[model samples]
Target: MVFGFLKKRRREEIRAQPFPAEWLAIIERNVPMYARLSEADRDELLRRVLVFVDEKNFEGAGGLEMTDEVRVTIAAQACILLLRLDDDDYYPALKSIVVYPAAYTVPRKESEGGIVREDDAVHLGESWGHGAVVLSWTSARRGAADPRDGKNVILHEFAHQLDQEDGAADGTPELDRLAFYAPWARVLSEHYLALRTAARTGRKTLLDQYGATNEAEFFAVASECFFERPVQLRTRHPELYDELARYYGQDPAEGSASA
Candidate 1:
């Protein structure tokens, strides 16, 4: 009760502060999906954005200085994932966001059966299960600037954060009820295998081919397509689209068509 009260008070304080005109302009100029939201949803998104920006620590990495534009842009897209949900926990497990100037490389080591391979792989963004999200500021800005491209580093990484909330990032987030799990598993598994088949067969698919890599990657990639190209997602993969709509509590198909 005390924590809820404190959170309510903090939300009130955040709402009481005036949203900067410059930030509004930046959102309008950069995020096309902002214009597609209904008036009430827009208000809710703004509220969530304010809370997200206030609660999370933004750290600079790779000589990238954190700015209001960087923070707000990243927060806005992340908050969109939570727009229809309740309880402003804001990915309680996530504590900080680290921003890089551009694509960054991290060393990787993996063992298969008995062999271990080591190499460095370039990444645009990554979400750690522990407490951090790392992103490339350049990729983030481009994703925000072109919301219709169906590729967003922020959305992809944050979707991983959501998936990790249940102590696993195995393509499933916390659903509304235990009963929903069966259907989620069925739909996701079927589509995931289909995507893998499409990838191997050189067939065109609506969801990103990268999704075929793994269940977790599939969820994140599907989320990007769900928000950015809902119409195409619905037209091509209606079952997957419906499942996402149920999970998100938002029908983005109309918004995408109108936009």
Candidate 2:
């Protein structure tokens, strides 16, 4: 009861404030993906972003700093994912978004006490436990500007969050009902294994090799493709595309066509 009241009160506080008009303009102009949503959906999404930006705590790391531009920029992109699915309400689970100036490295240990850093490896975004999203400003802008290339930092990170919500990044999120799980497992398993095998054999495929890392990554990478390259993903891996369609309850290719 106490937590619910606190959340309600906080939302009320945010509802009273206004978001920057310039940021909303940016979202509409830069993200054609957002333009596909209905006007009502767009209004609701902007409202959600308004509250979402207010709800989460943002940390600017690696010399980055938080500003309304940063918050609105990130929030608009993140909220775009919710425009088409059940993602919005659950996103409060992620309370912090750590933004770096560019693609920051998560250093790994090398053999024989050697340190190696690959500065050119740029990851646009990542999401972490307790509702944290990390992103690079440059990639974020480019991603929103062009959604057709099957690469989106915000969608990519939020896909990670969806996988993590069930307490494991196991290439699955909690389904609406138990019945949905059987087909989900069946289709995802088949496609996941195929992609994994293809990755090893160096076969050409639509999904990125990063998906080969695990089921979690498979879900995230596939999700990036699912939204950005909907027609391509649907054609390349129809079963996986169908399962994601069932799960997300939206079809981007279909949606885009109607638009």
Best by TM-score: 1
lDDT of 1 by residue, 1-259 (tens): 9988998898889977878888888788877789999889888888888888989999999898789989989988998999886646899999999999999999999999999999999999999999999999999989888878899989999999999999998999999989989999999999999999999999988888999999999999999999998988899889899989999999989976766
The local distance difference test score of each candidate is 0.91, 0.78
In the predicted model 2, the residue pairs found to clash are 94-131
Q: Kindly give the number of clashing pairs for every candidate.
A: 0, 1
Q: Candidate 1 — which pairs collide?
A: none
Q: Largest lDDT belongs to which candidate?
A: 1
Candidate 2 global lDDT:
0.78
lDDT of 1 at 153: 89
Point out where model 1 deviates above 4 Å.
111-117
